[model samples]
Target: MRIQKRTAVAVAVALIGSLTLIGAGTVTATAEETSVALPSASFRDIVVDGVHDRVFVSDPTGGSIVVTDYAGTVVQQITAEEGAAGLALSADSSTLYVALSTAGAIAEIDTATLTETHRYPTGSDTSPQNLAMAGGKLWFGYTVGSSGGIGSLDVASADPAATLVPSGRYWYYAPALASSPADPDVLVAGEEGVSPATLAVYDTATGGLQKRAERLFTSSPSISFLNDFAVTADGQNIVVAANNPYDHQIVRLSDLSSNGSYSSWQFPNAVAVATDGTVATGAVGDFVKTYRPGSTWPSLHEYGVNDLQRDGLAWAPDENRLFAITGFSYGSAPTLHVLPDAGKLDTTLDVQAPATSRKGKDLTVTGRLSAAEPFPAGTTVEVTRTDAEHPAGTPVGTFPVSTATGEFTFTERPRGTGDITYTATYKGDGLHTAATSQTTVTITK
Candidate 1:
């Protein structure tokens, strides 16, 4: 395996085989972007297992899934089939499902052990390109010999079966697929080609068509494709990455009506929605732009990452981090970029106790969690105690940060003597890193 870092210009030039400027348009770059090198030359998709604190990248050419931590550190590499194109994490985050396009199979990798435990045949002559998990099943899209469609497998069955969705086929490319997080039974499939593009919603349980929207890109005469799309966690909005013109379109799921359209970047290939309702779009180069729920303009804060064209983006709400897979096209090497929320956090801890108190006397511990502003109400802080008897220390209690003052306090009595120490920790939310503070008190005979 090889690892090397390349700039946006270098990646773009390498991908196009020359720096002749493939497109007539230009993207605005406001700040510098950061990037981490990967060991693979080709990439297809990215997924984050926030519960396990790991990011997975599918490298179809390398036939491996590269795993990294929230810090972008390479932790492990699991060998896969020749064409490991799409990836999806189990709802519980225990198993990672990968589509082996060339092998015509899907493999399940144990997230903890970083090993492949099982493989199931997709039973399709065409190669599968995208994978989604919903309704306790693994769904995939495939295209071969001018025919394409969607298929799914029951994840819970002892002997899973691959069943094609009724009337799910298209004339050309496999439609891009996304499932609603709020309602697993709801799915959105989009088709992009020379003909008029189309979008359809399906009910996974009954295999029924809920709604279909055609003529997605009415203005573009050139071939159009659905580069990427996502459904808001609340199941209220569907966002699509319309390529030819490089526009983002939001549609209200309730009525299949266009909510709004925002044209901010040139050729955005990936888009994702956070649990907090923030929308992120990954364009051809340098930066990932985020926007507030109701606003079409970019957010005040932006995540700058390498110009390597991004193909997939996933948000890990637990860590407040975004995982992006780069180098989708061209001969450029694939890279995984881990971007944490942009900002700094401040925290403090204090102790109130006699310098030399009785062994069983009560002691008070207090702390305040602060950043640019006070944290949200009901935020939690962990308290731990350490003494000579138990040098390793033990978690004693947990307290909530006050909404009004950002203060948290708790009382405890020392059971043993000899320089007891109290420590408080705030496990940073989506916008901050974990911080800790400690104070010591002595016990008398």
Candidate 2:
């Protein structure tokens, strides 16, 4: 009952105040955020349909799916289902599958028409909460009274039905599921509502489910209480967000080994991976951060918000923008924030120079610019020199990087004595984030 109220004025003030706060590190990019008030107070999941240019948000409490355009304007609201929660879109973005928790079914909505054409009943009182599509099947996490399990609905079947997976009975609540386009046959699930959560990776190739690996976070106290997690685009790793952890962790999907993490504020509760392998992680601390694939360093972009709800993050198929659902406070209408240009690749810049160089002598400054995506041809890095004389820094030269190796080198004569700092900055282009690295050298007689 309380979830039906709206506080547009208070929500608007919170959005404006959040804009003035820096969400992450020094290199965080500024994102223009546009928020649209929603009809629901409680939300479960978000999915973006790039083909139809629609964003769907499911509200379990309201028992409906709120559909919006790329601009966050509500185009339609489908209330044919009860307790609508998680959402998954077909590869072609033609069909949207909704998990009807109270109705115990998966509703299929024709994206173009914005109508529910069919509802495949999972069973009586299954209470499906989260959904993912992989191996040509719609996988769902469901609860039956006190127990929870995972099941799949073969959407392509003539008479589609939900078949329970026996390997999914290890949770008190329905787990969160994730899959990757790169490895469509691989599915990953993390137990929800359970501290010291257990994560299981499944091999669903050929439409068969088999457990490949699993890990219980009991060994690491920081990893308890799973909030949200995602399988990387490459399907080689799983990025996890936990309540006790101050960072989102990247772990191998094979053995669940430690890989890397995207460090951020505490209470990381939501995460999503873009088609381009860019990872967007959100925390209730009111920040959403994006990291390039496989990089544990600082994020490429971080945007501030009121508060990112659990399972609140989704990226458009084109990776052009990100759609986030916020506003979990009581008596507030949920706000959909559209973040433009939020999927840029991250780059690393390293500048190396001789430890000592003779005054007025030639010194070579060399380094490399590395990124998951290749740099454009003829990419150049701007180099600067800073010392006691040029405290503000002086332009040394613009050096070109070997596109093949991302390495760049330039020669500069040391005119200023004492410790001279050579700073190499890659101004970055549309595809990559700007990176800067510095190395110091002493100038001697």
Candidate 3:
């Protein structure tokens, strides 16, 4: 078997090069980047508690969990049992459940107090990997000997019993696991190893398997483990980050079929889907990029942070913020990044033309473009003309805006009488809404 591969940096450059053909109207949104260093270099998972305005990071090697504020400020560090790897937050965001691999137990932490409040033992030898909160219970994947499977603990029930889903010999202790936020009955799991990776969907309500798909990489030995995967808020799409060329695959949940695949600038270690249908990817070297589903081209929003060791990405809908965990790779220090939601731009278009002009005479059209933030100096604006003869309008021409004053001008000779409408439009960047302005001029014989 032959395997195809390309470096993420080269792909990003090619994507950027292609943008020039789409005209200068497209602009990349700028992000304010801030980082908070962690005491330990080794990090596993990260979760956000919107209700408490805090973020939690698991430091397995340090045997501690670091807590930070929404602004990426260190708040506190709470000690945990050894091998604290995966983390899950309760529905109300009041309690955080942690998987202590070495201790073979799940520990619960109080958000306000930042302390371990309770510990539930899974078993003496089971090593839990990833955790999810669904069906009013805590679902986790554990590896025992050569086999592993999914298990759940009904935290809501008075007894809170731990039970494993009945499945034949399967590798349930995969690196990627997620539960649908909209539907508690849906759960996604996958196996990451030298053998072909298998992705499966389970119906938690019936403990029945819904669907499974196999992903075989020709050169599997060279590929590392699958790191990040997310289920869309609507529970309709599953995004998985796979190695050996470092690409993201989107799968439709209804039929478990491939929807699309995307290339990244770096190995995407973490991925997340926003409530509003935005997909964010955090890769090695702190390269973060976002895209709209089903689009062939990448969006203009990208963020870069120095010495960012990619780990996990989490979205906080209530606060409109993205929290990214960086560290545990490339000999870089562990840090947390806080990126605020993209900002909106206010745009205005002004058109100037003679009130009346003679037929066959030059009709000079001028316009100025302004926005909340300064746009690229020579960005292009499209112009169109409509007259009584051709009310539908026809392309006049495309002129580049003046870098000095954000103004554009075009001269056209009239050939017909009656009113002529000249319109100037700025087809907005993905981050900002587009704007249009027009002015009418009367031509008499």
Candidate 4:
């Protein structure tokens, strides 16, 4: 397999296709602002299998998928039979399932062997797009061979002794797949002209209807022709993608385990949740809404990715990677980008502070932490300066992130000028916290 090092622009040198990074000049926005610099790497499709310790990405145009370590080196590559589009890695990250949309077949690849060992016949016109793994079975999207509409395939559970679960159910056009929130139910996200595109769940043990959202397909005029989803952890949520009029959404899974009943919990956009436990979504023209579990309405935040637009997003189990799949709409293979380390995401820092000083004056740099989540008081928040450097006179003191509201302050009088940066060592309880960048203050002279 051809492995290429990253170039500034996705050049036309060959294996995949030309991945040009036509850089644009810097543009700016506010709190809903252009704060963090966009991340580097990109792939056609990106999936991080924490169980396997590597990321799996599909190369539809290239006809192969490249696997890489957390450090971003190509570790393995799987070339599909013909037109490889959909990719599904098992929960354990050992087996991989690839869909041959044109060939109307699904090939199961042994990740360890990096080889295709099992193949199933889906009929012609069966355009398999994305495949999902659940309850040790494989479910993929398809178009009916005859009438031609969406459908799915289910592989039977194999006997424990056999590694290959060879005998199982293979379906089409009946009950299509619906997306779910971190649950074990098989989920599919779109339907033909149906409102809200019904999200259904079947019992893994019975392969029968356990629960579903009957008219979720009818969010008329708001959402349409939806398909495919990236589920949140616990499968309690999923971000829906629809085209033929493209728009996106992050909706909640109807919790049905309790009564095998139907319900819609009004969740939205899986990508927003990828940022933190918070779910953020809506059209660019609409408000960029944000919310966690207990909040009333989602708080609004807005910004643009000058060179990038995200159609899908994922959060790792370790919660350190806020990753996105880019280049889907522009006809380029998806680029896998890792933005702001998860450890750095500090919700504890989302509270309001007392104040700041005059540009040239030596003011105490300080703020109050929200509470004790992952980063409590005493957590080290590292400070660095850009532009001209913290105007020479500011005394750099390490302040404590208060345990109560986490009120923290550092005595750093101005030396000169700078784009002040704070790298917080957040031991906070939030999902995205690894080492987050606090607001960058520019000191003026």
Candidate 5:
């Protein structure tokens, strides 16, 4: 076992080679994107367990689950039942659940041992396609013969208990499922393989599916050929990706009302939300975008990938890494792409002052600290004065910026003449990058 594991690791690293960041837009100087070629011919789902520092990729075609370290180094490939497809991790991440579509059961694996410990059967001929754990149950979207629907397995129950929700029988194909820890009682499902796909939000607080809100996209801001979707960490909004929208749609989970959308390249296909409220979206084309919560614009770190698979993105809980599966072309072999510092949103700070001013006069200094997300209330920007006397740049003042606008203004008196420069600096917060901008003012007698 030791020798085989060592060889597998070596082969995985060799296949990874060295990847260079290409076709990036506003990526931070320190951000690096890496890729590792997988041994599988196809991919169905990707899940990251920050607790274990492991990434699990399910391959129905290979009937296996490929495991890798945080750096994309192959750790082990656990053989699963036939048709290993959708994957979900337990809330604690100690256990991983895999949906075996052909076997009509869910395989439970101990994450630490990388071994299949149990197989819970859904039913004969019931092919589960997607899995979501919420409300203390393992909910799944499955197909029974010609019709498809959703079901759940009671993980806490002593017996292998499964319930096929009767309300889910109306779908043409199996839907994709998503849930959030922030809202533990909510489960979201979207229909597959159909235009104007039906999306529904369910309340699982009662231990059974109760329809909360449903939408069929036939009106304005229409969606078609639903590819993937996700619920925000706070469970307040659902992000949708469809073939016709040309961008990811965001809506209130309460009423299914349009909240906003994240604009992306053609063919928006995948969307994932980090625990820290960072949103990562993918497209079939070259670009993938990450946005801070409630921001319509892609964060400054939006970068490009070759071609992302449908439902191919996942984020580490700490936001340190983003895992994406990509192929050079449709129906080709896929590779796992790991982006380092995936949560760092770049910021912009600009200082404005009078172009010309007289010595001993007060000047209005104005600036804005721009980021993917708004700064909180009471956030301040530090200003420094640089003139003939203070070339080292003396601290002038720190003023609060508008929480809504990120704009700030202050008054400064220049004692020295000649060209004076005012520098505005936003030191950055946990998820944002520091930024500095300066504007010079000529001071005369």
Candidate 6:
């Protein structure tokens, strides 16, 4: 694996690598350069192994999977032949799985040894692609015969439970499968390889159809395949990439919620989602790098990922340091870049005062932590008053949490107050404070 140095200039109307603000014209932020590593395969597949803070890049060209630490060191490399393509890892992060499109078999790699421990044939004439490993089993998209959808292989025990469960026998070609981060079910995105490509959701655990949708936005007759997208780590949400013909926009799953049409949500990516379900996606409308749940304003300042030729995209548990992978022609191999890019974490703290207050008297305010993205777990969140519309040190309360979650709600309602200030601070790991987000309520005294 090698890394290179390159610069990405933002679109005239788009910010290169920033998170978007709600109603502002895109803002641009500058990133400092840091070392990083690029996959040996020019066309590579990437998956995050959160259990170890390591991300594995599958290089079909080299028949290897390159393992890089958070600091961008190539710690290990596992090689395989037959040109491996799609990749998957178990929910517990114990195994590394691959789809050998040419080999017509799913190859299993033990992350411990980086060696091929097992391989199962899909069919004599099968083309298996994009994999998702979860719930004591492995799932894949198999474009075999007149069948489409996904196939399953369970390697939970020594008996070798490998079974192919085709979702629907549509004429659809290759598709991508990912287990829902928020649920036990799985979501499968596929296209018929022509106009009106289809994206379907299936229950691989039970072979039940949850949803199958068509009318996906695509302009080309021979449409572009969905490269990479993600489901949230919690498993309740799923986002997919569907390039609408000449129109490019990451589709949103919320859009599909209305009719359960599978027509709702949108987000684009080449490869996405870490084991924890932290996703980094490519942008469609204005900027280059974007993450969904809808882009906020601040991301514009950081520069969304642009210039794929220069950098590869990565997400961090901190939600602040984004590792950009790049390649340069070195004397022996391409240069490895684990470029450290910083992202703005606009975390705000909000708490309801006397949340369930009775009528009339003013309830005291306490601070709570709300985040755009997950930081680290076990981080502290403090509560405080903004200014002297009141007094200082008004008996503030605090809590500890992993900055890596949606939000944390703490109830330490203050009593007998006209006005009060509460602050949440994350001490240790350096001192950090949330923007004072507050709310007020009234109760009968």
List per-prediction Cα lDDT, in the order shown. 0.67, 0.79, 0.69, 0.45, 0.80, 0.50
Every model's TM-score: 0.69, 0.73, 0.68, 0.57, 0.74, 0.59
* Model 1: ten consecutive residues of lowest lDDT: 22-31
Q: lDDT score, residue 283, model 3? A: 64
- Estimate, for each residue in 178-223, the C-alpha lDDT of model 3 and write its tens digit: 8877778777776765344566677667544344434433342223
User: Which candidate number would show the highest TM-score if scored against the true structure?
Assistant: 5
Instruction: Give candidate 4 regions above 4 Å deviation.
Output: 1-45, 71-73, 123-127, 146-182, 192-201, 208-211, 216-222, 227-252, 255-303, 306-311, 328-334, 342-400, 407-445
Which stretches in model 3 have alpha-carbon errors above 4 Å?
1-31, 172-175, 207-224, 293-296, 306-311, 342-445
Better of 4 and 6 by lDDT: 6
| Candidates' RMSD to native | 12.7, 12.1, 11.4, 12.7, 11.8, 12.7
Model 5 misplaced regions, further than 4 Å? 1-28, 328-332, 347-429, 433-445
Question: Residue 318 of model 6: what lDDT?
Answer: 40
lDDT of 6 at 445: 48
Q: Write the per-residue lDDT of candidate 1 for residues 333-383, one digit (tens) a residue.
A: 666666555222223333333455677878665555544335676689787
Off by over 4 Å in 6: 1-39, 145-149, 169-171, 207-225, 233-237, 245-279, 283-301, 304-306, 309-445
Clashes of each: 1, 0, 1, 64, 0, 70
User: How well does candidate 3 match the true structure in TM-score terms?
Assistant: 0.68
Better of 3 and 5 by lDDT: 5
Candidate 2, residues 116-213: lDDT per residue as tens digits? Answer: 99988887778998999988899999999898888999988898888988774467888789998888888888887677788888888767678899
lDDT value for candidate 5?
0.80
What is the Å distance of residue 38 in model 3 from its true position? Answer: 1.1
Clashing pairs in model 2? none
lDDT score for candidate 4 against the true structure: 0.45
